[model samples]
Target chain A: MTQRQALSQSTGGTARGPALALDAGLLCILLVATPMTGSLTLLGETLRSALLFLRELSDWMTKKKLLAGSLAHYEFGVEKLAQAWTLAIALAMIIAGLWIAGLALDLIVTGESQTTSGGLALAAVTLALVTLRSGLQMLPFAQPKPRAFRFASLLVMQSMITLAALADDPSIALLADSFGAAFVALLMTAAGARLFSTAAVDLVDHPLNRKSEAYIAELLLEAGVEEEELLDLRTRRSGRDIFVELTINPSRAGSFEEARQRMGQLRRALAEQRDDLDVAIRLRAPGADSG
Target chain B: MPGPTRDQKSKEAAVLYTSLADLAVVTILFFFAVFTSSLTLLSEAIRVALMLLVEFYGLFVLRALHRDRLRRFRFGIGKVEQMCNLAIGAALLFSGFWVAHSVVAALLSVQAASTPLGLAAAAVISAVNLLINLLGWLAMAAAARDGDSAIYRAQLRARAVKLAASAIVQIAITIAALAKDPVVATLFDGIGAAFVAGVMVTIGFKMVAECLPDLLDHPLPGETKKEIEAALLSAGIAGEELLRLRTRCSGSLPQVELTLAPAGCASVTDYCRRVTAVENHLKDHLGGADVSVVVDARKPAET
Candidate 1:
């Protein structure tokens, strides 16, 4: 198979990581920032609560079945409803996260506590929960399932990096502003790279699209337009639209009305086969410079 | 039929609201930047201000699109959105490159200052921006649920990106606030600014690439072309030899043109009937397509 075909086949798998990675990258910045400014008093519990909240959120989402399992099986207008539901779910997660954070903040500001070794376990759980939450959050935003998977993978990467950073020193603030910036920069670069690659594919004609031109040629030939009568035919596909051009010589001469009648027959014949054909037909004599 | 569909009108209103909201936010940000001495704040404010202006112009384009759709213009100005993509893409790219440069310079030589108030202000603005964008996204998403319009999809993406960007800014600013050292805070601020820019540029670049084909009037996809060709070919009449065929698409509508030479001598009636039949056939298949069939007496010279 050609490279394009190969890419097309594996698009499902390839699409799974980037979006997740990008989301993760964003979360990484957030996770890194959390402990930087806040009081360390409730750090473990707050993070642990955050993890618990994510688990509950995930379970709630699973129970509700908010996201469509397969977008294709659904009818056209229905997809949007699913999309809206997903958006609502994402919004709800954000609101919930904020609420939990507020409660955590209240606890931290009101009371004082010492840092404990449990901080490590809480941090790990938080990382896992955040990764799961990020994936769910991105689910509605991504169109195809594979793209969602890709996004989840990216989120995982981001979560891992942030977890590593947090693991280094939970008490003291790390002057790692560059790290956040670098994480974002790296994600952008990766996004840019993907864009360029996708652009390359889009710029060229897909094999299926190319086949359409030939298909048109075959259809005309099958319609009994002799090879000699057919002057020129051109076909091109633009996104979801199609363009076709055909030229042929007539076998008989008659008045304009008679000619139009004959053209009518041809059009009806073509229409019977396909209803959504945008066709323009031109008639010319055998030796004319122009029509 | 008499006026815009409920969905269309709602979408238009949503776009208008977002554009105005963006303008307001950026204006507030600009004033905040003016009062603060942070280079990062000033730069981002300028960047966002440019974005709002571009979005304002985009609102005009959306208006044009609505008017065209209402009038049922033969060639809709749908591709005009491509221009928005181009403009926004430029802004994002410029911001990214500029911010990258700023971050590099900061890394090489740091200018240390304490601006807790500025950081606090940015954090608040980021929160407000986030709220605005989230609501906008919800509105647009709901609007999009009825039918998938390219404009709606674009708006959705834009709102989501804005939300993400705002959240990132808020986090970065808060981190900077927590840092003990002034240089460390500056570094964090620079990083956040750069990250936002990077995401913008990446997305903007993709937008430009996606719109280029539409702006350039690229050919329709293969399946659509095949459908059109099949309809025209099957519509052919006896004694009529197909000569030349050409097809193109404008927005969602397809257009096909073909040359045919009728067999023997044909009268005006015959020509009319033939052309009418073909036109009708095409109309039936490609409902919204602009189809035309021409009969030519003149033929190519024999070699």
Candidate 2:
């Protein structure tokens, strides 16, 4: 794909890579199956999941003894149930919108399976997907870009599946399925390749090590250590950890006892700042200042 | 004076050749993915494309700055590296979120379908990614011998994200094969994707966090601070009378400001001369020193 197309596809655009692949697979099934089997099978599959969800919900509620409670307790349970129910409703809406859009797109493209329910579903789903995608795309930052495209792909695939369910000609469904499969496969491969390319780039630098080293240097300076008094100042990284080595001026730092106390304080401060650093402070007295 | 030292020429060639090789490899990978016709493959290819864009931009900035190719940013373009680091983090975050969202959708829409072809494709992609990751590691090892380089770190982070994603895809494929129930298979797939996404997000956040302090002008290293104090003392300022020493790094350069007491009665010219001398000494010692020194009249005992 061109860079622009790839960008649009990666972000929230009409093209959804993985979802489109799924649509192709579903399209193949639709082409092979008659309308009676295609649409009805989809309906049956949807119903089966819905029933399974309800059964699980029922089991959970029974286990929790949701109904075996006083009026106040019952009220609290209802509040909790309402929150869950709201989420379930939203999920149902998105699925419904997707199913309708799929049916509508198939009808439009194939010039078949045009029914009143299909028409209404198409219009409603189209409007919903458009509004949702637009709204999501408007959100600040890159957070919503992938999500918006995901919604778009869902709409497209569902629309294709709906059309496949209603299509009278097996050939059209098969053709769409084949095309979709090829497209999806191509998209996935491209994505994998992108990942591979990124994998090839491994940075050799450790910026964190540098920063920590600088922080340590500042600590020593603030502790009354002369800059020139520090000898063999070295900092490096071993994996994720930073190692620091420096010599301090002890003679200028008052008594030997005081210098030791200052070193302790500096070490404590550094530890508090970064739990990952290994600092070694060597004290050089007046005569021992690398004469 | 020389046309270019042997080491300089070698570095120049390494940078140029590496960029070209990287572009060539990714371009070839993109084409290969196009022919493979796998969603998982394409998804990664898109990431690599975006990565190449960021990598090249970072390299371009780095090369220009190293070669003194940019007049506007003559001081340094360390911030460009920071910005690139930020971009890489943001990109990974975006990809992670994308993968998570897709996984969730798939989990919700679990269907009873066997995807042998998709599984095989994912396996192939995983193998290829692992191989590339291994190669990247070797390159990293070679680079590390020369001291920790920022460019290599960025590349490592990016490589890690892709490696994790590939490994997850491989796991998902295996799970799909073992799970008889399509729902179970879909669940495993979703979980694998989520795991990979989590890793990507975590690494991305870490990279961004690490770069922030550098960009924000964090204080100079402790050793550098000690060195600054030593430089001042050696320049005739006594350490006991030195009231305060403040130091920070701006870009790749050291910046220092100090307050000290002069030894004897000195004229304004004498003080300026001393400050200039200290500044010159710092520049020589610390390298690229931006120094500010003030002679305070009060001694340590008085203060």
Candidate 3:
């Protein structure tokens, strides 16, 4: 495998992290902005109550009698729904986390102590949900669940607090924000349940993406190495990275180091296409038994 | 480039001609209604104008797209819809704010004034507007399906939104005219305009966001990255860097640039042979990729 291809695999296990982080950031902003909206506080709760709704939706879609069982990412009768639910749940979790954190910083932690219990709980739930989803995404690679679904609990509790707030309740803006997060999350979950009722895995042809193919062509065209010396070529793509195998003739040389030098040049050229690629170069005799 | 299919070309011409005809109808009606200061006639004329504007927008967009087919989102032209969404969304949002403002004010100062001729005008306007909008909807769908342009897509969406807006306004006008409440009728128009604005703004925001990643240069699909690396490895070469790769496109073809170490060939002829092999390998994997290779030995190597 080429070094760029190897790097892709190594990094592939972590690509979802950024996506999770982005979602978390978006949620946090929404949750924090809740208290500022005053009468629009219910809008914020849209997020807090979202997690349970998503979980319920996921369960309904998967029909997984129990949420505690070990289910592979691929297996399911309603896999598409499950996948959609998972994505929604994960997205909600991230959003909730951001909301709670923002709420905590903006109102919960600094605000009155007694009124914040609900907000704190919902934030915790959101965190937990986010952690669970992130963990699942990378489980095949091995790592701790990124965070706890603290936002969910926080969202639910905050929502109740918001209800209280709405009816001449205390100044639990923090709680209101958490509740907003939950509410939005729940609504999204419900909507997603209807829209997505199965796991989703995208299988696509990759090498056709143009960048990889062109890069390879450039290397060979520029290398100035004889096409006759080049015996065979094979390429396969999985995800964004392409793995290449080729065989070429070894010309008369004073030393094997010269051939090695030529190989190094080729490697350097390939790297130009993508530094994060895995490349495997195999030297073989002409017309030898090759797979 | 594949020439436009016969049906597609014919449909394109029909859509354009029909839109123009619709515009002419709107103009004639508008003049006829305004000559007598008929509010009902005026409302119908406005609907016709909007429909004409939408069609023209679709036509121009289609023309531009056909002229420049290379413009696309990654490998496809998905970004056109995305951009249109942003612009329309913004327009809708702005329109919504304006309509809301007018409605709030009108509600505060409920005024009733309608030309005595308004009763006769209302019926004519309602009939004309309804007919025009329905025709516009059909024309929009045809243009949208036939032309792969953001304008056509936006026109389609705009028509759908207009349908709802027009329906609401129609209901409001019908009730107000029955009650002889001129203020309510005016209020309905303002609200309809506002609704259009708000919808456009929402669509605009969505488009802007969808297209942001491409502008930011996110990596290509992972499978593509691996394919290129594997091709290099299979060759009798090793230690090559799949250096900074940029995937761009011209029309439908992908353009790839791979910077690599200079060929370490004993002779220039031998060097050309090796490069040709890699090029062939790339072409085999990715059809019609324009590859550019730069030879620079000293670079940060990835292990």
Give each model a TM-score: 0.47, 0.43, 0.39
Top TM-score hit? 1
- The TM-score of the first chain in every model comes to 0.38, 0.30, 0.35
Off by over 4 Å in 2: A1-291, B1-44, B70-74, B111-114, B160-188, B218-247, B251-253, B257-269, B280-303
Candidate 1 residue spans exceeding 4 A from truth: A1-254, A257-291, B33-43, B67-73, B112-114, B181-191, B221-227, B237-240, B262-265, B276-287, B295-299
Model 3 lDDT per residue over B1-303, tens place: 555665556446755766766677788788887687664456546545644654665566566556565342223333333333433443444345445555565456764534535634554665565566677777656545543455555655656665666666666556555555666556554555466556645654564455433322234455776776676677654645454455543223344556444346555335545565666667667775645442333323542
In model 1, what lDDT does residue A262 have? 55
In the range A1-291, model 1's lDDT, one tens digit per residue, is 442353344333345346445544645544664465342322322333333344334433332332323322221112122222332233333333333343334343444323233543344454455556546766566368644754554454445445434655532212222232233334333433443333322222222244665666666666666678666554433223343445455545355654455555665565556543444455544444221
Worst 10 residues of 2 chain B by lDDT: B294-303
The per-prediction CA RMSD against the true structure, in angstroms, equals 17.8, 19.7, 15.7
Error of 2 at A60 (Å): 51
DockQ, computed on Cα atoms, for candidate 3: 0.02
C-alpha lDDT of residue B122 in model 2: 54
State the lDDT of candidate 2 residue by residue for B178-273, as single tens digits. 677777776676677788889888888888777654444446666777877787778777877576665544345555656554554234334344
